[model samples]
Target: MHMIQVVFMTVMVFFVIVTIHEWGHFYFAKRAGILVREFAIGFGPKLFSIKRGETRYTLRLVPAGGFVRMAGEDPELVEVQTGQTVAVRVKDGVVTRIYLDRLDERSNVVRGEVETIDIERKLKLALNADGVIESFDIHPQALMISKGKETQIAPLDRQFGSKTVGQRALAIVAGPVMNFILAFALFAAYFQMAGVPMENPDKLLIGDIVAGMPASKADIKVGDVIDSINGIKIGADSEKMIGIISKSVNVPLTFTVIRDGKPLTSKITPKKDPDTGVGKLGISAAIPSRPVSFGETFTYAGKAMKNMTILIFGGFKKILIGDFKMDDLGGPLRTAQVTSQIAEQGFTQLTSWVAVLSLYLGIFNLLPVPALDGSRLLFLGLEAVRGRPVDPNRESMVHFIGFAMLMLLMLAVTYNDILRLVRGEH
Candidate 1:
């Protein structure tokens, strides 16, 4: 039962995070006047779809991938009717699509066979090497049965290629930007709901007493709020209290603690911790918690986001330098398993993990790998430098190769995940 909950929570997190990432592209693409034909969550055959404005929003069969299809992003392929072949001829910047099939004059439509029939749609067709149209798809509104007429799906300006480099860059960068924003917002909200820690300046509230430690030996117990240490008033500064204890290491000090509204004094010697080289209290104090102030909440959230980003980059650096084991890398399976475990802990734990995962994803997408936002931005950089775009064919090939490599890597990591699971290594 717990395992099932973990898996469900993990999958839900992925869905929400990926949706937000894709929404970033959709939002900016629309803002840049680019035609987004489809905005889909997941891949393969769609489970459900709805067309609104110019875009078809879809939920697909596979949760591993999602995409935003823009006009001119991929070469368009035209479907041929049964027993029909499509041929295109370009003359003086006009493209003509001729269907070799029988035509019925009475219906003014292509019907059964007639020697060599030409059902002509005369418009501009950009042909690729395969002789299929390089661009354009049939639009429902522009459906035409009339002979020698052209049908247009997208206008020239609405196409992705028609956008300026700056506009395109903005659209490409938006995905990563949105991911970071979501992480920061979630972190802020979590802090606001869970409350923030505020150290008590006037006293130290003992939260835990370590077994066989100096404080425990001295009869110090949990909830013994210390009002003073070594005759010095224990103020709001925890560091100062620690400093006093550190200086008095191996020496006896007087402690004034409040226990259930009663003041009690005791003498104990501070001992040095061999492992940490710090004065040992054998007792842990809990900071007081309070609701976050409006301004401070965001500050805490921003710091959390920043620290997580640094941690991700640091870990990546270590992995690159061989400081981390390759087997330690967790793919989707491990992510799901870990997410499930975190979910079992509580809502706060799961939410914090989501924020951390969001930051990780945002940073990962920004790595300059092909088929990623970072790589696209790199291509834009080349375009900016040369004052023109790179050949689309070459760009497409690079992305294809990159995507293939990524899929293979995911497979390998997934295999590792399964192996670990079988061994009960989670």
Candidate 2:
């Protein structure tokens, strides 16, 4: 049951984050008049799909990621050879529809053998009808039918490459921008619910107790003021209490707290952390906080997000300097495990986790690595500097290789996560 809950929450979180990211690209592409072929959630075989206008929205089997497919972003060949018979629906001497299947039942269909075709540029089609070679212009909104599937033929004006460099760059960067916006909104929501923490270094009040930890097992509750430990007069001195507890690993100590205007005593043994080799009570000191006005929440949330950004960038710097370990990297499995642990803490903590994940997604996508939005933006920058864009075939190959490497890295990280889980390590 626990595993099921973890999987469900992971999917829900990924769906919301990825859908919003893809919607960003979809919106800008439509604004730029670029033809978006599909806005799909997940990968692999489709579970459900519906076509609305030019874009087909699909839900697939995998819930890990999603994409927005823009026309002319990929190489698509409309293979219509000479001497191949096809049926067409004509309107005002222009071809409105072309059917490659032989089971066409529509009336007023013109059957002919293809003589010449140019769907991308001139949109002209020459057909050999009977003994006469007749040419007709294809409509800009023309549809092509093959094996019962219908798709609009994209012309040069509606292709991604045909747009201005500025428009293309905006369309590519919009996804990451949306992710940052989502993160900010989530952080604001969290602040509204939990309020901003106020510094109270001198006090020794319990703010929260970790579930199943020593403090929780000892029946320690939030709002309890620690009066002393092992009969020491440690009133209001949080640092002194911490020093005494850290040195008493695996040793039972008497803790006296002021609760409900009366003194209560409990015995707790601090657990030794394997990584830090230090005793931990798994309880946080209470920093007094008061509810803020409605407008103040946004101010605190912004500051919190800024701090998180700085911390994330610092971690990246450590990794670049070879000060970080590969084992510290977490993939999808590790993320799910951590998310499940946070979910047990209640909704406020879950929202905070979601916000952090959103920020990570936004910043990671902006890295100048091939197969990411940053790489596309880099290509656009180069195009602006030069007179023409880079060769499409070469760019595609680089992105493909980068994508393979990323997949390999994901697999390695997932293996580590599984190993850690099996060994009962966090």
Supply every candidate's count of residue pairs whose N, Cα or C atoms clash at under 3 angstroms.
4, 0
* Cα lDDT listed for each candidate: 0.74, 0.86
* lDDT per residue as tens, model 2, 1-426: 266776677677888888889999999999999999999998779999999988999999866578899989886545778888988999999999998886357679888899998888999999898979989999988998887788789999999999999999999999999999999999999988887656554446787788768998886687788778899977566778889888989999898888888889999999998898778888877665567677887888788789999999998899889997777898888888888877766677888999998888889889888888888899899999997999999999988888789888888898999999999888
| lDDT tens readout by residue for model 1, 53-90 | 76888999866668899877886334334435334333
TM-score of each: 0.67, 0.88
RMSD (Cα, Å) for all candidates, in order, is 9.4, 3.0
Residue pairs clashing in model 1 are: 6-340, 126-134, 201-235, 201-236
User: After aligning candidate 1 to the native by TM-score, how far in Å is the CA of 208 from where it should be?
Assistant: 14
Candidate 2 residue 104 Cα shift, in angstroms, is 6.9
Error of 1 at 353 (Å): 1.4
Q: Which candidate wins on TM-score? A: 2
> What TM-score does candidate 1 get on C-alpha atoms?
0.67
Q: Pick the candidate with the highest lDDT.
A: 2
Candidate 2, backbone clash total: 0
